[model samples]
Target: MRIVAIANQKGGVGKTTTAVNLGAALAELGRRVLIIDLDPQANATSSFGLQGVEDISLYEPLLGGALVTEKIFPTQREGLFIVPADLDLAGAEVEIARMPNHLTRLAETLKPLQEDETFDFVFLDCPPSLGILMSNALAAADELLTPIQCEYFALEGLVKIVRLVEQVRDSGANKRLELAGIVMTMFDGRTNLSEQVVAEVRQHFGERVYETVIPRSVRLSEAPSFGKSILEYAPSGAAAQAYRALAREFIQRHSPPAARALEAPEQ
Candidate 1:
């Protein structure tokens, strides 16, 4: 299984949005996907209609010796599951910091899932910070999927996350860690500033940046309130289409050739 951590140090960059919608999109393609909500806000958990599950959540696994699989819950979408998060996760950073082998705790916790091949892909919706939580996610993930907003400070946040990834890899926390891709989010076609930001990011990151850009849409923002992904809430809309394109690109880029060949016959 391929584990991807959707992370960005800066908030309001569509990190949770991408995690929910993209996971749903991948599920639509028949891939078994699991979204692990690591944010204290639990936006991704709420997006899947799983709120008020505070008693048993990611906090249990992060704080106690509870298995992550024990807390996993199925979403409305087929082939998709979620390990929800709660407000209690806010203290996890401090708690995890005090533990032995703290940096690799999440990795150790996820080893069983990795061995079991429970899901085709695992998307970690991380908090918007470079704290212990984010560090743990980086160590657990095989690759980082960063969501960068199309705004003035986009590059600044990107630089910080890139440096963190480098540090994690160089420090031997996760030697196999590499950037899977950078997704441009909250794009506004009408604004020159948004276009300039996308251009600048693409110029710097080149092929590492995804061709599918997530537009700023009211439907996209409204989906989470109704506890749905854009694919379920606005499947025929532009936002859903964008995420679908992103999933297609993601599969093409990440899936092995032999795997693609096997899927093609079924398709």
Candidate 2:
């Protein structure tokens, strides 16, 4: 199994949205996907129609109260699962900072899950900040996927995250952690600014940037309010189709050979 931290210190960049919809899209394709909503806001939790019920989040697990696996809750999707978060998670950060090997706490907490390989992919939906939770996530992930919005200052935020990944590796937190992919979100087809941003980012990152750019659509923005993913709420819309295409490209690039062999073309 692979653990991917979907993070961006810059807010409104589609990090949580990507985690919810992209994870749902992969589960729709028969992949067992687990999302750990590391953000205290619990946006991912609400995105799936779940309330951030007390004692059901990673807050307890991170603080050494309960097993993280015990917190897993199934969503409406057959194979998609999540460990929701609550406002209490905001306090876990302050407490975790005072603990030993503080940075590796998440990694240690996730060791058994990683060994179990229960899911094909584990997506850690990080908060839009360079806080303890994000640091812990960076230390535990095999890969970092940053969702960058198509706007001014996009590259600035991308640079900070890239440096953070390097620091995570250099500090012996997780040497294997790599910036695996850059997802461009909120792409407005009618705007030259959006096109320009994508072209500029491509020029620098090349293939590291996925070709499937998520479009700016009302449907995409509205899905989370209804506690659904774009694939479920707007399957025929451009944003949904874009995410589905992204899942295909991502699987081809990152999935094991055996998993790849099982992949079928999109319907």
Candidate 3:
């Protein structure tokens, strides 16, 4: 299974939105997808229409308090699943501060699940910070997908994340982690600023930037309030189409062999 962490140390960049809707879109394509909400805010959890913090979450599992598989929960989607988060997860950094190999705890916790082979994709929605939680997500992830909002500060945040990824790798916290792709979110085709940001990001990241840019749409923002993804809430809308396209691109980029096979022949 491929583990992709949707991460950025900036808020309102559409990280959770990408995780929820993109993950749902992948499931729509018949992939067994698991979304682990690593953010303490649990935005991804509520986006999936689930509530309650309960005794199970990645917090407890990675900290050695509970079994990782025990915390796994099925969502409404047939093949999509989630390991929801809780407010208590915010305290994990302080609690596990001095624990040995704290940075690797999450990676170790996820080893068994990755080996299970039941899931084709695992999306970890990281919080908007470079704290231990984000570190854990990095440690657990095979690839990092950063969503850059179409705004003035977009590149600033992107640079920080690129640096952090370098730091993490250099520190031996997550040597195998590599950037899968960069997604441009909240793209406003009508705005010159948005166009500029997209161009800058593409120039910096080159082919790593996804061609499917998520447009700014009210429907995308409003879906989470109703506890649904754009795929479920407004499947025919622009936001849904954009997310579906993003998911397809993501799958193709990560699963090139499958993509090549599908393109191979009418034999």
TM-score of 2: 0.95
**12-36, model 2: which lDDT tens digit per residue?**
7899999999999999888999999
Task: Write the residue-wise lDDT of candidate 3 on 1-267 in tens digits.
Answer: 988889998887899999999999999998899999988889999887787857668888778878788988988888889999998888887666778888888888888887778999889899998888888889878999998889997878878888888888999988988887899999998989999999998898899999999999999989988888898899999999998998788777776697768865678
* Off by more than 4 A, model 3: 261-267
| Tens digit per residue, CA lDDT, model 1, 1-267 | 998999988888899999999999999999999999999989899887888886767777776568888989999999999999888888878888999999998888787788787799999999988888899999999999999989898888888888988999999999999887999998999999999999999998999999999999999999999999998898899999999999999998887898878767563
lDDT of each: 0.90, 0.91, 0.87
Best of the two (2, 3) by lDDT: 2
Clashes of each: 0, 0, 0
TM-score attained by model 1: 0.95
Arrange candidates by lDDT, highest first: which order? 2, 1, 3
Error of 3 at 58 (Å): 1.2
Which model scores highest in lDDT?
A: 2
Better of 1 and 2 by lDDT: 2
Model 2 weakest 10-residue run by lDDT: 258-267
